[model samples]
Target: MTRYILTTCLCLFAALAQAQMRWNQAYQQYINQYKDLAIEQMLKYNIPASITLAQGLFESRAGLSVLATKGNNHFGIKCHGWQGRAVYHDDDARNECFRAYRNAYESYEDHSRFLAGGQRYRKLFSLKVTDYKGWAHGLRAAGYATNPQYAKKLIEIIQLYKLHEFDKARKYDKFFARRSKDIAGKGGVLHQVFEFNNNYYVKARRGDTFRTIAAEVGISYRSLAKYNERNRKDILEEGEIIYLKKKRTKAPKSYKGRLHYVKPGESMYSIAQLYGIRLANLYKMNGLSPDYQIRVGDGLRLR
Candidate 1:
C-alpha cells in the first residue's frame, strides 16, 4: 500500500512539473510574439519596453486571458472615454467595460498612446526609458492598477525575462554581450567578438561591411561607423578592427610607457585602430597636429 501511494505521489509531482514547464513555455512564446510591438511602442512613445511587456504579460496572463484572446486587449485597458470597439470583463466591478482592438498591434499601439496622453502618467515620462523599476512603481502610485503589488509583479516579470534589454535598445547594445557567439539568429554572418580595455570589438573578415557587421553584432550600422571613425559607406578591409565602443582616449594600462614605431604601410589612423585608441587622442598624445606627417620608423607614444 505504501509503495502504491508513493508511486501515485511521484506521478502527480511529474504532472505538476510538466504543467509548470508548459506555463513557462507559454510565457516565453507570448514574449516572442509581442516583443517587437513592445519595442516599437517604446521607441515611438518613450516608454520602456520592459514595462510595456510586463503589463501585457500580467494583465493578459501572457495573452491567454479572455479579453486578450477574444477582444484583443493585451493591457487590460478599460474604456474610460475610449471611442472604439469594446469588451466587457470583470475587474473592480462585474462586467466592467474595456477597450478592444482589431489586433494585438493595435492594442499595443493604443497602450502607448494611452500612457503618453494620460496626465497621471506624466511623471513616468520623466523617468529614463531604462528605469523599468521606477516605471513599475510609478504605475502603481499613479493608480494604473488597483493591485497594491502591481509594481512588484511587473518588476518580477521584467527580471524573469530580462526584458530590460529592450529598454536601452541602442545604448546598451545587448548589454555589450561579452564574447557573445550567440549572434547566430541576429545575422547569418559569424564573427568572434573580443573584449579589451573594458570594451568590446570585432574583426572585419573578408567581404564584411559596416552594415553586415552591425547586423551580425546587433548594433546599429551608423553606430558601428561612428565607433570606427569611418563613413557609413566606407569599405572594411579584410583584417580591420572595428570597435563596438568608442575607442578610449589612451591605450590601456598594459601598453603604458610603450611606443608604437611607425611601420611601412601604416598611418596614424591605422595605429590608433591597432591600439583601440581614439585617433584624435593619439595625435594629441604624441604632440602631432591634425595634419602631421607620420614617416616610417618615427616613434609615437601610445599612452
Candidate 2:
C-alpha cells in the first residue's frame, strides 16, 4: 500500500509540473506575439507598455480565455459605454457585457482608448510612462477593478516576467525603428554639448538617434550607450539629454543634502540626469526602491 501511494504521488506531481510548464510556454508565446503591439499602443496613448501587457495577459489568460478566443476581448473591458459589438462573459456576475473586437489588434487599440478616454483614468496619464506601479495602483483607485489585490497582482506579474522592461521611453524596438527614421523625421539635426556636475551631455536634435549621435561623436554605439548609462533597450528622443559619459555617484559635493522637489514631466531617470548622478546611486541615496513612484510634490535627496 505504501509503494502504491508513493507511485500515485509522483505521478500527480509530474502532471502538475507539466501543466505549469505548458502554461508558462503559452504565456511567453503570447507576450512575444503582442509585445510590439503593446509598445505601439503605448507610444500612441502614453500608457505604460508593461501595464498594458500585464493586464492583457492576466485578463485573457495568455489569449486562451473564452473571451479572448471567442470574442477577441483581450482586456475584459466591460460595455458600460461601449457601442461596439458585444459578448457576454461570466465575471463578477454572470453574462456581463464585454466589448467584442474584429481582431486582437482592435482589442488592443480599444483597450488603450478605453483608458485614455476615461475621465476616471485621466490622472494615470500624468505618471511617467515607466511608472507601471503607479498606473497599477491608480487603476485600482479609480475603480478599474473591485479586486482588493489587483495592484499587488499586477506588480507581481510585472516583476515575475520582467515585463517592466517594455516600459522604455523610446527604443529600437521594431515598432520604434519604423516610427523614428534616422532622427524623428521632423526637422534638421542640431545639438550643442553642455556640462553639468562635471559630466558632459548633448541635447538630441530633431531627427537625431543613437546611431546618428554615435557616428557624429565618433563613438561606437555600445560605448555611447554605456557612457550614457543606458541599456540596450533605451532609445534616444529629440531634445532629450544624452550623457557623453557615465554619470557620477551623487550630486556635486557642494550640493550634498539638498532636497529637490519633483515636478510635472519629471521621473526618477530624468531627475538622475538633471543632477548628473547615477540612477542607481540616486535611488539608494533617497531610500527609494525601484518600484517607488515619485509624485509631483515628492522631495528627493540630492546627495
Candidate 3:
C-alpha cells in the first residue's frame, strides 16, 4: 500500500508538470504559425508585431476558439463596413456580427488595413513600433475593446512570451535577404548591415561617399541623407551609421528603463553611432537641443 501511494504521487506530480508546460503550448503554436503574417503587417502598416500577436492570441484563444476556427476571424474584428463574408458570434452581444475571411492570411491583411485606414487608430502609427505597451494602451483608449483590462492583458502576454523580439528579428531577416540579393546581383562584397529599432544601417567604410554608396545600393543620395537626418554634403566618417531606411521615433523595447552613461569624449553623434540610431532621432527622444552638448556621466535614455 505504501509503495502504491508513492507511485501515485509521482505520477500526479509528473502530470501536473506536463499540464503546466502544455498551458502555453497552444499559444506558442499560434505564434509560430502567424508570426510571419504579423511581421508582414508591421512592415506594411507600422503596427507593433507584439501587439498584433497578443491580440490574435487573446481574441482567438490561439486559433482554437470557435470564432477563429469557424469564421476565420483571428482578430475578433466586427463587420462595421466590411462587405466580405461574415459570421455571427456571441461577443458583447448575443450573435454579434463578425467579419469573416476566406483564410487566416486574409484576416491578418484585413486587420492591418482596418487599423491603418481607421482615423481613430492613426495616432497609434505615430508611436514607436517597438512600443507594444503604448500600442496596447492606445488600442484600449481608442475603443478597440471594451475590457478595462485589455491593455494589461496584452502587456502580460507580450512580456510572458517576449513577443517584441519578433518585430526586430523579422525585419532583420527581410532586410538581410534583400541586401544579400543585391550583393549577389552586383557580384560585390556584401556590405554588413546592422539593425536597431527596426531600421537597417551600414557602417561607413573608408572612402565610402554618400553618392557612391547610393549608386551601389540603388537608392538616391538625397533620400539616404533624409533617412539618416543628415545633409547630403556632410562628410561621411568611417564607422558612422548610414541608415538604409528611416529611423524609428524611439528605441527598442529592451532599452526601456535603461540609461546610457556618457563616457569621457563621447559626443551625441558618437553615442547615436554606438546604438546604430539616427542622430536626430536620438536627440528627439531625449528632447535635447540641436546645439546641446553631452558632458561626461550624463544619463541618456536609449528608449
Candidate 4:
C-alpha cells in the first residue's frame, strides 16, 4: 500500500510539472509568431522587442483569444479615444471596447507607434536595448496596466523564453533581402518596382532597420513604405510583413565594408591605421568632439 501511494504521488507531481512547462511553451510560441513586429519597432523607436513580445503574449494568450483571432488585437488595447471601429468583449465580467485593426500587422505597428509617440513612454526610449528588464518595470511604473505585478509578469515571460536576445545588434542584409523578395513575389505592395517589406517586424535574434534594409536591398525607403501600405510615420512590428521591390545591389559611395568597435586602450589613430581610413574621415564618421574621447562601443563607419 505504501509503495503504491508513493508511486501515485510521484506521477501526480510529474504531471503538474509537465502542465506548467506546457503553459510556458504556449506563451513562447505566441511570441515567436509576432517577434518580427517587435524587432521592427525596436529599430525604429528603441523599444526592446522582448517587452513588446511579452505584452502581446500576455494579452493574447498565445493568439488563442477571440480578440486576437477575430479582431487582430493582440494587445487588448482599449478604444479610449479611438474613432475607428471597435468590438466589445467581456473580460472581468463587464464588457469593454477594444480597438480593431484590418490585420494583425496593423495592430502590431500601431502598438509600437503608440509607445514611441506617446509622452507617457518617453523615458522608455532612453533605455538601452539590453535593458529590457528596466523597460518592463518602467512600463508598470508608468501605469501601463492596472495590475501591480504587470512588470514582474512581463519580465518573467521575457526571461523564460530568452526574448531579449533579439535586442542584441546583428547584421542581416541577406536575410532581409531574401524576405523582401518573398513578400514581393506574393504581390503585396502597390509598386513592385520599388517595394520593400513595410510591415512591422522585430529582430528575432538581431537584425536591420527599414532604412538599412532598404539600402541593402536596393529599394527606396519611400517605396518600401508605399508598397507595404505603411506610412513613413508608422511603427514596425515583429514578424510583420512589409513590401519588397526587386532591385539590383548598387555600390553606393557610402558603402563602407563594416564598422569595427574600438576596444579598451584602442585609440582613433590605431583604428584608422588598421582600417586604412584617414584620420579626418574617422573623426567625421564617429562625430568626434574636440576632446575626442572615444569611449568603448562608439560606432565607427568603415569603408
- Give me the candidate number with maximum lDDT: 1
lDDT for residue 207 in candidate 4, whole number 0-100:
46
Candidate 1, residue 238: how far the Cα is off, in Å: 45
lDDT of 3 by residue, 112-206 (tens): 89899999999998899898999999999999999999999898888888899976754535443233223212211234455576776777988
lDDT of 4 by residue, 102-219 (tens): 6656677778878887898889888888898899888888877888988887887787788888887453234432342233111111112221222232221124346644653456
Off by over 4 Å in 3: 1-23, 170-303
Off by over 4 Å in 4: 1-25, 170-303
- lDDT of candidates 1 onward, in order: 0.81, 0.78, 0.78, 0.64
lDDT for model 1, on a 0 to 1 scale? 0.81
* Cα lDDT of model 1 by residue, 9-73, tens digit: 99999998566433376677677656666776788899999999889999988877888877778
Judged by lDDT relative to the true structure, which candidate is superior, 2 or 4?
2
Clash totals in order? 0, 2, 0, 30
Worst 10 residues of 2 by lDDT: 179-188
Model 1, stretches more than 4 Å misplaced? 1-23, 171-303
RMSD of each predicted structure = 11.7, 17.0, 15.3, 15.3
Q: Model 3 Cα displacement at 213 (Å)?
A: 47
